[model samples]
Target: MNILKKVILIDDDQINNFVCESIIKNERFAEEVQSFEWAENALDYLKNTAVQQPEAFPDLIFLDINMPGMDGWSFIEEYKQIPEEVTKNCCLFMLSSAVDRKDIISAKSLKEVKDFFSKPLSPEILSFIKEEFICS
Candidate 1:
């Protein structure tokens, strides 16, 4: 079963968002890609959306670690406000350039984040995502 479908991209970096969105779309990995420049807006979207219907909602989320405010870390903390269904079925990956071991450890601690990948995202990363989350 193809698990990649509607996806949300939350990153303050415009280039990162553009590149990832382009890659995801060009590869037909996600049918829809919604982007947010900050985690706060992304959170607000999640908070208002009905994710219980997994087939109709976003299948995954790509969150960025470094942002002006409400970074990926902060967003994860506030993600508790979102419905449990949203957290259960959908996948969330931490896409960042941070090579810091501490950051890696921190991301691993978050139950919502399925994988921590360093950017810029390539075909291999995309494939891994598909194999791990989409096909699993």
Candidate 2:
């Protein structure tokens, strides 16, 4: 059985999105996985779903730190405007290629960010997340 109902991936890298989606599917971590190349699109999706289909809102969101427009930090700023009822159950994590200490520290500082992970999402990491956040 899947531990999560749905998961969202927001990253500018199509390859990363493909790889992460495959891992999440292969692990059977979630029933559904949706990916967005732009953070704005993802945010719009969340907003629309929250209003029109609350039950369809994602259970987990893996977001990238770096993007062409509306980077991860900026996305969070906008996400905060969303109602708590829409985001209260959603767990957000930073999945980025950035290895800078400042980036990690900054991500950790955010209350909305559940955790920070390096690029290339792995099955082991998915399992850990399932257990740590979803199952808990």
Best-matching candidate per TM-score: 2
Among residues 3 or more apart in sequence or in different chains, the pairs in candidate 1 whose N, CA or C atoms overlap within 3 Å are: none
**Against the hidden reference, what TM-scores do the models get?**
0.90, 0.97
lDDT of 2 by residue, 23-131 (tens): 8988888899999999999999999998999888899999999998899999999999888888999999999999999999999999999999998899878888877
Q: State in Å the error of residue 64, model 2.
A: 0.2
lDDT of 2 at 29: 88
| Model 1 poorest ten-residue lDDT run | 48-57
The clash tally of candidate 2 reads 0
Model 1 TM-score is 0.90
Q: For model 1, how does the per-residue alpha-carbon lDDT over 1-136 read when each residue is reduced to its tens digit?
A: 2347688998888988899989888878887888999788888778767654444657888888899988888898888667776567788899988899999998988777888999997778889988877787
For model 2, state the Cα shift of residue 53 in Å: 1.2
Candidate 1 achieves a global lDDT of 0.83
List the global CA lDDT of all models.
Answer: 0.83, 0.92
Candidate 1 Cα errors over 4 Å, as ranges: 1-3, 51-55
Locate the minimum summed-lDDT window of 10 residues in model 2: 127-136
